[model samples]
Target: MTITVSNLQPIIAILAGILILIAPRLLNYIVAVYLIVVGLIGLGVLRHFS
Candidate 1:
């Protein structure tokens, strides 16, 4: 199975927003991991999406 970039981008943005809003303390870690993972996925460095 695979997930398209267009499909996952918005959801990732929304989840990041919610997490930042609901738990300010986790913003750093959440954003860091999100950026790292998304960067890899976007760059085609990894292909685990499904």
Candidate 2:
């Protein structure tokens, strides 16, 4: 299936979940990175749609 912008969040969530499951210690870093990335997206700093 094609990966559109809408599909990116869930895919990332799934991957993050798996990573967290494998290594619980990564929770802090994962959350921090996720928030930063999402914030950048919201601010149009990272344009996946363009």
Q: Say which candidate scores most in TM-score.
A: 2
| C-alpha positional error of residue 5 in candidate 2 after TM-score superposition, expressed in Å | 2.7
* Leading candidate by lDDT: 2
Evaluated at residue 47, the lDDT of candidate 2 is: 89
lDDT tens digits, residue span 1-50, model 1: 56677788898889988988999898899888978887887787787662
Q: Candidate 2 lDDT (Cα, whole model)?
A: 0.87
**Residue 25, candidate 1: alpha-carbon lDDT:** 96
For model 1, name the residue pairs that clash: none
| TM-score per candidate, chains pooled | 0.67, 0.82
Which pairs clash in model 2? none
* True-structure Cα RMSD, model 1: 2.8
The superposed Cα distance between candidate 2 and the true structure at residue 47, in angstroms, equals: 2.0
lDDT of candidate 2 over 1-50, digit per residue (tens): 97766778898899999999999999999999989888888899888742
